[model samples]
Target chain A: MTPEQFAARRQAGWAELESHLAQARRGALRSVPAADLQRFGVLYRHAASDLAIARRDFAGQPVTEYLNGLCGRAHPLIYRGRPVRPSALPRFYASGLPRAVRAAGPYVAASLALSVAGVLAGWLSVRLRPDLAATLIPDSLFDRMARGEVSGGIGDAPVAASLIIGNNVKVALLCFCGGVLLGIPTALTLLANGWVLGTLASSIHRDGIDYRFWAYIVPHGVIELSVIVLAGATGLMLGDAILRPGLLSRGDALIAVALRAVVLCVGVASLLVVAGLLEGFVSPSDLPTPAKYAIGAGSGVLLYSWLLLGGRTRRAAAPRLQLDAGG
Target chain B: MLPDLHEIRTADNVGIGYDPAGIGSRFLAFGVDTLVQGVVVIAALVVALALAPAGIAGTLAIALFLLVPLLVSVGYFAVAEALTAGRTPGKRALGLRVIRLDGGAPGLREALVRNIVRIIDLALGIGVVVMFFDRRSRRLGDLAAGTVVVREHRAPTAAAPPGLPPPILRTPDAGPAIDGVEHLGNAEWGALRTFLSRPGMAPDQRARLAAVIAERLCERLGLAPGAPERQWPPELLLERLYLQLLPRMAPAPPGHGMPV
Candidate 1:
């Protein structure tokens, strides 16, 4: 048959499918009448079959191109990703986050170790040569310490909380994404942050207000630092995918690890929210030093317990349909 | 024979092809999205600050100033893509949609991952460079999320003039016989069909293009290139050749060459 004759015979079905798709795109397919919904499926299958035939017989023709596009548009409607459920969020916190963290334990440990190395380097450098503290610590912070203030001069708790949250989340995201460059940026970020902490601590120690500084920092620092470490871990995991992609190609490996890394990032973001709240409200408050330390230690325990033990008894959740992102 | 056609097999065993959006369109879309995001953030901050009462409510305004832009930067793409099943305002304007490698709409998780990774992709024009090297023009976010941005097929415009009618071929006995027509590939056949179906060409230009195509077809068929144009006009010869090749190009009947 001529291309025109073939198009004439199939045009009605294609038009029907197109209309159904338009309706589906506007709202949900479920909104369509039952009879029409069934017809939509049938029409889609027919279009799919027609696409196959056109690809074989009418290759390079506009008819084939049209059929291919029709099917491409319709395929996603037929095969959607798993629907979002309210339970998914709660379930993720209870198990998904912890499970992913455990799965990527080695990377996290490496991240922690890198940060510790930075801390030690900064601390030892400052301790050995006190003059180094001038360069290592920011001038505003040093001047504040040189005087008698330990608080961050945050006037409004809510404003500071939002700013802290924004900054922390940005840093976490940067650390996570830096893994694409083979983990160099991720490592550097962790070390740089840790070095700043160490230098500040050394400077505070020299001023004899080390205890006061810890009281202020520990309330939020415990969770904030952990979240940063977790973020670094996610980045390292991405880097590992590039560095040692096992059997898969480098792109495939990056994708495979990214799924879990993103889940960890969500957890990191959640923790940073908590930390930011504490930093803005609790850390700067006139609370007793012992009480602030207690809050820090208690929260750390709660956080680790959740990560280490939160969904151990349950069987794995039913596998939901996850669409692969690659071709 | 279209370039950059990314094909995936569906559960029905049919191959569906997607045309990946190229770097130029995606960059344009990004530009639009950035402008939209900036406008939205500035407007939101203005309204938020304007509404802030004194004392406690004023703190909220300050907080909004710090948080609003960051949230919008990440949330804008993620929420838009998730809600629209793959398109943001910019993408829709540019006729692009994001889909999984397996040709499914991205869910919220995919959307979040894709956008969060955009931090790196947007840094220092890294995404553009990465897309340059990637076959599907995927940036780091797409590679990580396993998704691709594809150009949507535009519906035929009503303003377009009606296509020319198919060329009629004389009966085999009435016309000069043409042989070895099957040797012409789809490329040659497609060129002939395009030449025949197109309208509004100057007669002289049409005759010239037809002669060129007919000569190529003659050379492919092992006949003297100039001989066929002598007996029949080059356009007439092409129309006849198109009709002769039609049956050979028709797909096999169902259950013969159909995908199982």
Candidate 2:
């Protein structure tokens, strides 16, 4: 039959569905009469049939586009149902976060080992010739440390907290994004950070106040350093995809690891907030050395417990993607 | 030609095809979002500075300067994405929305993951370089978050389209005279041919679809519903209907549109 004749017979049913859908979109679906609801299903099925027929008979016509749009609009109402729950957040922290971190554990281990080696090399170089520390430690930062002004001197805890968090997050993101370049950039960023840390340590030791510096850093360092490590690891996964495609092609391998790496980035970013708060207020406070040490140790235990044991209640299955082989 | 179409399978097992927004469209959307974010950050800094005490100095001043603006810039995407339920103002303007592949709404975690990974995409000229390698035109953020940005489909706005000509029936004649076949109309006759043409479907689906077409055709044609002649199933009934209608259905003018 001609498209017009098809429409002539079915337009009334389509119009009825249209009115019902309008009401539904307006959040008035509950008030829609039961009779209309029943008719909506029949109309939707008929429309689906029309679409199939249109593809076969009316191909390349405006009628096909109209049917497709109509079906597209109706499909969600017919089939979509996934309720957002408050419990999902708790579930993610409990199971999703750790499972994600563990999945990228090998990458994280590689990042850790690489950064540690960078650190040892930095320490060795700086210890052998202390003057080289000037190159690693920026002059402004060195001056600030010398004058006891390293905390940005802003009295507002929030301001300090935000700065610390923001800076660390940026560095973490750089470490992560750098992985896109076959991971060389990622490794370089991590090494740069590690070398900087080692140079700073040696410079602080030269001031003969290394003990005091440790007390100031330890509270936040415990959490902050670990988060950076995790981020570096997550970033390295990008490189791993390019470097080791495994059985999958390079593109597919990248996609495979991208999900887990992104998830890890999410978890570690949250951890950075905690570390930032500590660095802002507690690190600068004249709290005794032992108290600082205790806080540092306490956070270490807490962070590890959260990562290693928080989600041990069940073995969550990883999500699997199903790709269609097209005809 | 580039293959930009990707299909999302609904729970009903129907595949819904949507064209993912291309990188060019995405960059435009990002440009809009970034402009808004930049204005917000500047306004915030202005307020912070105007209200601050002159005595403020040292690490605190530097900290506030560095962090608050950064938070606003990044948080603009993450928080707006969540509260807007997967669209920022830019996406809303562009008629784009981030949707979870699994069919649910884009949740907070997915939003955060996608937005954070966005920074990485931004480095490569805002996903321009990365999207080409993806099947769905996804940047790193989308792939990682298992989300896709699709144009929000609009409902049909205009009148229904013109009719199709009657298909020339290829079925060898199915028995002699099926009664009351004239009321079936050209469209109904075309529909029967459609049902006959679909091949290689699973047996059950084919039978079910054939039955539905038969029932609809019977209702439209004023024929007795169901298999009155039990020996001849609906598919066979359909074959007979097409055979009877082919000669009777009128043909349309040449050059009327038909799919190749």
Candidate 3:
């Protein structure tokens, strides 16, 4: 066959493999358990095979086939005969949930405390002088917030809420992903964020617009902060996996711990989105104090229940899942 | 060929063999062991540095030269083996054994060869590329050392022997020839002693071996088997053989022989 012909076939094979991968992704979302993982391995072997065929070359006639053909061959090898042992499921869940919680516990606690103190300080600063809000927020951002035209700051409640939730999710992701880099960066990021939040809140409180600030912040702060706390926990989990990898190799420990961390961050992000929506649409000032507290406290209870208690009572908890920043 | 019944039976008896752990578990073990050990080493070095701050540079240089290599070797094997050894913490944790082709204990030389050759196993820049392709999961180190890793079987639990009697010491007065046998040279005595002390032979078998040695000695010394056995008993026969062979095996003492 001509080189062009081989290239075309290779392209076609790659397209097929991509489709197969897409299917596997869907399968994974549906929680196909061990079956999906096996299917993915098959796909990987096929992809490898296609790659081998497409790339094979010789002095006379070309030996290699299409790139997709090489992929097709390789895909199966990646996932061959990997039977899901009964133990794997329990192990998977345990690694995902309890381990993340334990590792992130100290970081989460410290960060959460700091963030709360920051917010309180921000409220106090706002109460001290209403004009201070001008100084607390950047002039441009303050103008946009006042005009309800801010794209990224606190004013565009809906978009801001989503962005806040997204950023928090990203932070959680960084925590888990950093396991490969030995979790140092993950911890650093969490502490940095916490410090920033603390300082910002203190500055906001100095502006002397306390009630207004609280009304705007508390509703979502409850959920957003909680998510961040969980994210911090996720980072700690990754670090622990690296620091105390147990009996696994560095690579294996990183991957395993990272996967579990992904699951947690996914769950945390889902809740954060909901909280952001509540905070964005309804300013804390608009709602009665009792109502705001109800939403905030209720969400916290629910999070604790699902993460810590629900796993025992509920038969199937959605496995925590994550996608990294680069992905 | 159809599956053989005997083969099936043997395979069935073996049970599930090695359970390969995935990468995550292996990383955990490596991290913990390395961190713990690294901390201890660092602490000791810190004290050393504090005691004589001036020596810090020299000490560090020495550590780099000597300490780093040892740590690297141990860490590499510990990490790799722990990850793969039934997902346990290296050879010790897994109750598995690694032996050289000659069936000797692993020594510094063996460790050095195996560790140095790991560079080849790495293949290009890909980590452990050689291992993935090689049968038996042997990387370059294992290949160079002619070593194989196998799971150790559990020791069987059984009672002690009931009928076997303890050895008795023969009285010296029973044979004067046996007493004089100590004058024998080393080579002949060594050979005779080795032959007799071997395990699991009946009394008749030992006597027959002794007789053969006695006959040979007699031919050389113009003495009979009866003469050796009657004078020395079985125990001292070896001593007598050695005494007889020394004159032939070794030349005369310095003064008695050619001038030094």
RMSD of each: 6.2, 13.1, 25.3
In model 1, what lDDT does residue A86 have? 73
The best-first sequence of candidates by TM-score reads: 1, 2, 3
Task: Report clash pairs, candidate 1.
Answer: A325-B101, A325-B146, A326-B101
RMSD (Cα, Å) of model 2: 13.1
10 residues in a row with least lDDT, candidate 3 chain B: B3-12
Off by over 4 Å in 3: A1-157, A204-209, A313-327, B1-260
Model 2: per-residue lDDT, tens digit, A220-245?
Answer: 98999888888899888888887888
Off by over 4 Å in 1: A26-35, A138-155, A207-209, A314-327, B157-174, B179-191, B202-205, B219-233, B243-260
lDDT of 1 at A164: 84
The most accurate candidate by lDDT is 1
For model 2, the docking class works out as incorrect
- What does DockQ come to for candidate 1? 0.46
Score every model by TM-score. Answer: 0.88, 0.69, 0.36
**Stretch of 10 with least lDDT, candidate 1 chain A:** A318-327
Question: What's model 2's lDDT at B200?
Answer: 58
